[model samples]
Target: STGGGLADYIPFIIFGAVALIMTAVIIEVQQAVRKIPIQSAQRTVGLRQVQSRASFLPLRVNHAGVIPIIFAISVMFLPTIVANYFNAAPVDTWYYKAAHWIQGNFAPDTTNLPMAITYNVLYFVFTFAFTYFYTAITFEVHDVADNLKRYSSFIPGIRPGRPTEDYLAAVMNRVTFAGACFLGFITVILPIATAKISGIPHNQMYLGGTAILIVVGVALDTMKQLQTQLVMRQYRGFIT
Candidate 1:
């Protein structure tokens, strides 16, 4: 019985290991940021003059983070959920047949190749779409450009104001695309790979890629906040 129990738990152990690896990879990817060099206008301190100070604006690849995953999952499940309500209809009826079809195809079961393909395709599309959508809403290029202009800071070689905004927008779109692709791959492909490799039932694989992504993304954001707070405290200590 002990040996049998261990064999039964093998799939779960594999799933957990995969989850840990996925989380680590996601966190590492999330930590990667593109730093744009900026220079502040020259200033004077007391009787002496100071040269322009250099700094950088850090832009994260996964700015939208888990929000996109949450949004996509909520949207993706609506069809299956709505179809389930018509389960009581006669099998010969259109609604019953439609509901069954949705349950078989759109539902979150990776065992069926055709259903898995359909579901993953839609999942990828929705996740990618929401990543771009959420990023667009949260990361405002014009605001960043305006703030930089107000602070008398400029990206090296780029003109301030409209040109700067355009440049930032272009860079952000490129980064967002990379992030979205990663999210989609994680959300859809990872679970399928786990099931195929581990010989685990798709329905029983609860530690899916989407869940891992959300967990890791939230952890990374929380760590970033704590680090920022620590930096602020250190700076305050220096000032006092």
Candidate 2:
């Protein structure tokens, strides 16, 4: 029989590459935000007309991008552990049956419709939950509000203090919801769809979905920074 093609190992290669690229992307994304002078109506003598120098906020979309892939892949493989445990159990025992069921149904590679559906549902739920959890841990609404207040930069139509905090929180809430849902959908469906469309096996797609998002997010952010640099140089954006 002909040996399996190298493409058969594409998933693992993709995973490895993504892991490295994501680490680099996250660090770069973090560096993108920096404080710049926003000229104020009033300023200190000898000091530039701009307000006090402060650190600008950098928002990284890839904050938890790799996290979801890691979790999903881990959960998908958990049934393998269950399988090993069950294989050692006494034959015909309930535990054995339960383990077999889990292995067969929850294994990410199988084409069993029921198991696939169940896995997708669980994946989506966990991804959604983790997305919010991570966002909450990372995004500091109070701190952002404080910084804005210190700089006297209020959200348009929002009063400084509690109102601004509330406004920022609301904006984050909406963004978190949209972003979480998008990630959840991609995590659940992209792999399955890629497998079907490309004639590749299903499990291969799990990490691919997450990789695409991270790469795209980093690329967009880099473009934004480059555009900012270009504008500073009195040149138009690359696209227009």
Candidate 3:
């Protein structure tokens, strides 16, 4: 008999429990939105006056999504990939030593204390930075502000022009700070957890939080799109 029993399954159980907990956290943060209230100015129509209406602009909490994760991983792998290409060089050469050092220190699967620390720290910093960078690139505060202003809408107390842009920029920075930290944590956490709990090396752990995030994000987005389509169909049918 192989004598496999509950003891052998403990690691799997712990991993499962951790996965479930993280799934909840990701779902909550993923769906979280900041709703900024706005008011539209009343305007005169051709023959009548239109009343102002209140609305909201919804900003997602996790704005960058998996893009930051992908960017961080790609960056983290680049140095290692380059370093490995120099493996054919003679061991006594400085270039070879430099390449070896680079691979040893920067490789994500590293276990050495100093090396692992360096890898995780840099990986985390890159993830955090990229989250903000990607978010800024995709969601232009100036554009949003201008659109709101053009539509005769103002975010409640905020002024219509440059002030509105400043307010939006401030809000976005604060929101992005939270999201950046979360993204960094999610990207680095599985490797850390694997190193600590499962006795499996970081490189051996193929299914990480990134995979889960992508899967869950895609599923949620698909559901939302499907729901929107159904609602649109319902409205069209009603109009018909």
Q: Roughly what TM-score does model 1 have, to 2 decimal places?
A: 0.85
| lDDT of candidate model 3 versus the reference | 0.86
Name the lDDT of candidate 1: 0.87
Give stretches of model 3 more than 4 Å off: 1-4, 198-200
116-225, model 1: which lDDT tens digit per residue? 67777988999999999999999999999999998789999999999999999999999999999988888878877898778897788767877777777777678889
RMSD of candidate 1 to the truth, in angstroms, is 2.8
- Candidate 2 vs candidate 3, lDDT winner: 3
How large an RMSD does model 2 have?
8.8
- Model 2 TM-score is 0.64
Weakest lDDT window of 10 consecutive positions for candidate 1: 104-113
Q: What TM-score does each of the candidates earn?
A: 0.85, 0.64, 0.92
The most accurate candidate by TM-score is 3
Which ten contiguous residues of candidate 3 have the minimum total lDDT? Answer: 198-207
The positional error of residue 185 in candidate 3, measured at the CA in angstroms, is 0.9
